[model samples]
Target: MTSIVSVRDLKKSYAGGFEALSGVNLEIEKGEILALLGPNGAGKTTLISTICGISIPTSGTVRVGGHDVVTDFRAARNLIGLVPQEINLEPFETVMNTVRFSRGLFGKPRNDALIDQILKDLSLHDKRDSKIMMLSGGMKRRVLIAKALSHEPSILFLDEPTAGVDVELRKDMWDVVAKLKASGVTIILTTHYIEEAEAIADRVGIISKGSILLVEKKEDLMQRMGKKRLRIELSTPISELPQELADRGLEIAADGNALIHDYDTRSDRTGITALLKDLQNAGLKMTDLETQQSSLEDIFVDLVRETS
Candidate 1:
């Protein structure tokens, strides 16, 4: 798990003395997808821009493949590819030309074979010769990805890659990310869609107010911070929780059709047995039972609340 990109004490400031990033330290491992989740104005884009050498860091260091981004700009930049949130492609330019042009920008020799392969990998081969304006939004996004990979960068940064994409298309983008990772491209993507992070990221990093809240394995984060609920369906509707049930930390659902008992998955004793026994003694009839686990969104919201 070698770090391909490392940020140490990174900070960015404006003339008005507004800090976008504050002493941020992060390590993006080689060949893994790291999803950066944050609200608007959380400095996610600024961090990506600085790492790609599009913006200068006010202080501290960012190393891409051990090359300083500020001092060794070309070398560091050549090893990185960035697909920004906007679809700013030249509408008149053909997709093939657009992607090929990106490769040439890196001083790479003409390698149409490689470019074609990248296009094919992104499922954009059929539209390669079409003008940017002719492609759909999802196809345009795929073209952006192709352009990023055209340079054969070791690290790829996707800033809100699926911003306005449909659900199916977003899933397609996830598949593309998987292929990129399998090919040893280290990906660090910023996403507003929390489920996108949950689906594809090996690790999830939460950033807020210019500082990183936490970075952990997606599963570990969910397990450690996530909660579970026992959804006990009642045979009859109730407007409120009975005194006995309220003491057991059970609450009636909004529709009053069931009761919800929230518990930690990591707990050894969930008190379910006692609760069920208590329910029987209280003359409550259970019609069905179901359980639900907290999603990544739940953990993200809770963390933001605590930090804010």
Candidate 2:
């Protein structure tokens, strides 16, 4: 995969001497969905701003489609479309005019046909002539996306695009994202929703303390850090574990009806045999068994805690 966007030793600092980004290095492949995961003030937004030429970097370099962001701002910025976190739009303007104006900003010729398609893709075709003030919050969000796509940039940056959005709206947003990627648009998004990142991203990047902590394929990251949980359900509920079972790595469920044992999938010996024999010896009958893997949220929390 060719690199569509490149960052090397990127750093950003304010006059107060607070650093927002520190020696960050990253590469975004062409036509891939990269989800950036981080807590508040973690430099996710700052990185996106710098890459899109909205902010100047204190040091280091960023290249979009082989154009330096600092030296050639217009070329680099022209290849990028940014959907900011805030919903800022002209309330008095119709959706069609709003989207059309954005296209003109990029010196694009008036193409109502392209603008209409963009609106339809965002499910806003019927509301094209409706004033922005007449639309709902969710519809306002779709208009933002339509405006971003109006210029037809090769890359799109979505900063908390689904924040405060309803469940149905979130689902619809991701479906639109899938279609965008299929059309060869490289997307970089900052989202606090771990499940959304896990679902839509081809790759996941974790950022903390103004640095890139980790970036890897979603499946690979989950498999590497994920733990398998063995659930041993008992025929009868027990208030407490036997003294003999206290030393083992087992926790009682909230209902006291099942014992939970977590083990590494890569481990050669899971200790299941010994635990089962001990349970039987203690007169605890195992009526059923179940298993599950850790979710991305579990791994994210653990990673941040370790780094902090």
Candidate 3:
């Protein structure tokens, strides 16, 4: 896929010498879902704002659809749509009217058909005629998505789209996002929901302290960085560590019912068999055993901590 959005050495520094973004570089494909995972002050929003031309970058370049965001602001901005983290809709405007106005702001001709489809896609058709202030928080978020799609932008930026919504509502929004991806809209979302990214994103980018730590395909990242743990349920509780299994470096569960061993999934010699043999020699009996893989949240937290 071709790159629809490109940032090279992007840097943004606010007054008082606070650096919000630090020489960031990224390429967003034309139709892929890229999720930016980061901590609160990790420059996720700053990168998005600079790319959308909302905040002027101290240095570097951002281009959308081959148009320079700084030099060809209108052309670049026209190709993008942003659903910000904040709910900043006009309280009294009808949903349909607000979406229509957003389309008009982009110099797009009136197209009620497109507007209707967007409302329906977001499950906001029933609320189309209702005032924005009369809707629920989740509905307001749907309206924000509707407005972002009003102009039929090739690229969409969702900044914390599911922040305040319930789990069910968040899942509904994920469905909406999946539909958008299927319709060939490139999506770049900044989210605290690591599970959301793990569920939907084609690629994951971790940012910390105003710089990108890593960017890789979701599955590949998990496979490459993921660790595994082997949990052993002992048949009998041991009061102290056995000398025979002392080299295993196992962790005893708080309840004294289980033992935990961490190992790399990619390693050829995980030492599970040897550990089991050692346990048997030490007169220990294992009642049950289970292995678990580390989740995306684990990988994300590890990256952020390493960089911090």
Which ten-residue region of model 3 has the weakest summed lDDT? 219-228
Models 1 onward score TM values of 0.83, 0.83, 0.84
- lDDT of candidate 3 over 115-215, digit per residue (tens): 99889888889888999999999999989999989999989999999999999989999998898899899999999888889889999999999999998
lDDT of 2 by residue, 1-308 (tens): 99999999999997899999999999999999999999999999999999987789999999999999999988988999989888999999999999999999998999999998898888899999999999999999989999999999999999999999999999999999999999999999999999889889999999988999899899897775568999999999999899889988899999999999998887788888999999988999999999988778777888888888
Error of 1 at 109 (Å): 0.9
Tens-place lDDT per residue, model 1, 1-308, is 88999999999998899999998999999989999999999999999999998888999999999999988988999999999899889999999999989999999998999988888878888888999999998899888888888889989999999999998888888898898889888999999898888889999999988899899999897785568889999999989776677799888889888999999877788888999999998888999999988787778788888878
lDDT of each: 0.90, 0.93, 0.91
Give the higher-lDDT candidate: 1 or 2: 2
**Pairs that collide, model 1:** none
Per-prediction RMSD in angstroms? 4.9, 5.4, 4.7
The count of residue-pair clashes in candidate 1 stands at 0
Output the TM-score of candidate 3.
0.84
Which is superior by lDDT, 2 or 3?
2
Clashes per candidate (backbone, < 3 Å): 0, 0, 0
Clashing pairs in 2: none
